[model samples]
Target: MAKRSFVWGLGRYLILATAGLLAFVAVVLVALRFVNPPTSAFMVAHQLSADDARVRQNWVALEDISRWMPRAVVASEDQRFLAHWGVDVNAIQAALDEYRSGGGLRGASTITQQTAKNLFLWDGRSLFRKSLEALLAVAIDASWSKQRIMEVYLNIAEFGRGIYGVEAASQAFFGISASQLSPQQAARLAAVLPSPKKMSAADPTPYLWQRVRWIQQQMAPLDGF
Candidate 1:
């Protein structure tokens, strides 16, 4: 009888502990709705390609992102950034078609989804990851704006070998301040984004040179404001 009574008490404690955990989660979610959480981020290789932007910290606003990085990424990565909430139906469909056809890895993550996964989630690209990315994307959209999302993306994306963020990427590659980077310099940085380790801003590969030109052309068409 004592053993059975002890088991019952243990079960009750477990249930109460579970409830408390759930309540804590609820409280956190609610607090996120009312206040911004201070971001603590990791600097992946590409994004932190240089030493200066190696450290991670909270990224706050659109102006901070725009001042540091080129506007070309907006044109290349997500032209519909301002229009969409968290997902882009057309882009998602195209990515699905390409994935189904086995054309390539993937190319359909919206800025918001990118922000959610890059800043807060893991880096695996799988079905489960995709589903959780969607969930987190929705949550990010509800919790932040397009400007905020883009700001976070630039700060967190792996740009190069131990270098992260526009500030770090610019300084590492061109030996210039991010705000001082010309459009061409910015384009070179953007071009290497897919494979920063292989590419170089100090001396771009032939492939990256061509891509940089494309990025430059795209930048002319962007309405970044």
Candidate 2:
């Protein structure tokens, strides 16, 4: 009797899950039809104990992404995160062009793609994962407002091995809230994302400083976009 009940419950969930997916797809198709330009990317964070195994970043507001993180993340990841939609086709193409022949791979993953992968999938490098990453990116862009997309990215981006979100990054690095990050301070924090344990916003390296300068250059073009 218990086994039968479990099976019934699983079946019910499967049905509901299917319905949810279909609804989500429908909404996305409608959004593509309308296609309003995106605003900002923001997500809240939740502080956690150092030893906790879950991600540490959290979301707080819709406004934090552009104001605090835009310059910083653009410096660290893609300066073109805003100019493109969910994917950076030029970056991808350039990467592919630069790849060593058949082995040439590209960084087509945009902010939306990164957010989708980080939130729902496992970490690793593979074509299969990339495919899934792209699918989720499109789905996310379809469903979320640009502001919402940024919100999720800031919240989900892994700051440390265990740390995540702007909130956690802010507290861990600056002992402040995400709302309080200055452009320089934010750039320093963004630098740590590639290797959180090695570098720091509080103590940046020459390379990070150079990267920061480059990101500033990117802002002008992005602003025009």
Candidate 3:
């Protein structure tokens, strides 16, 4: 009788704990729609680590950032950012088809999805993490505007080892403000998004230059979107 009572008590406790956690997360997500997040999980992690350098980040409004930047990232990362709600089903289908045919695995994460993960979740790929990311992405999309989402993404995305956001990255690499970045400079910054730590906008490798050109080509179609 004692064992069964203990089991029931534990189940009740778990249920309450889960509910409390979900409520907290919901509040935070809703709050972010109005408030610019001062930092992210990645930034916190880096700050906590003794070996990692201190992070550099500056918040800027979407309008203050270059027009080319949004277009470049849309072209380079998720072309369907405007259309997709939280997840891009078509990209997921294509990725699955590629994988089943013995092609290399590809990421199908949309900008919204990446924003959710970077803002609320931790690093690493796992079913659990992806599920959480999907849920939060939905919440973010439901609450935030597309422009707001882009603003948050640009400000929080890690551009280099410690450099965070277009403002810091532009200053560090090109000695320009985020608003002053030229088209070519924006393309170069977007090109390095896939792997910022390995790629450098200041000293572009052959592969990085190719990516820069491709992103520049894509920018034309994305204009005024």
Candidate 3 structure quality by residue, lDDT tens digits, 30-114: 8888899989987887778738768988899988998999999999999999988988999999999999999998889989988
Q: What does candidate 2's lDDT look like per residue over 111-212, in tens digits?
A: 788876766566578889888778777777766777677766676677765666788888887888888887776777677766665766666789978866
For model 3, what is the alpha-carbon lDDT of residue 177? Answer: 94
Task: Give TM per candidate.
Answer: 0.73, 0.69, 0.94
Provide the lowest-lDDT 10-residue window in model 2: 39-48
Ranking by lDDT: 3, 1, 2
Flag the better candidate by TM-score, 1 or 2: 1
Error of 2 at 1 (Å): 36
lDDT at residue 90 of model 3 (Cα atoms): 98
Say which prediction, candidate 2 or candidate 3, comes out ahead on lDDT: 3
lDDT of 1 by residue, 46-143 (tens): 24444555453333344644442537776657778888778888998988798889788576888777776766566677889888778778767766
Return the top candidate by lDDT. Answer: 3
Clashes of each: 15, 13, 0
List per-prediction Cα lDDT, in the order shown: 0.68, 0.66, 0.89
Q: Mark the 10 consecutive residues where model 1 has the least summed lDDT.
A: 39-48
What RMSD does each model have against the real structure? 5.2, 7.5, 1.6
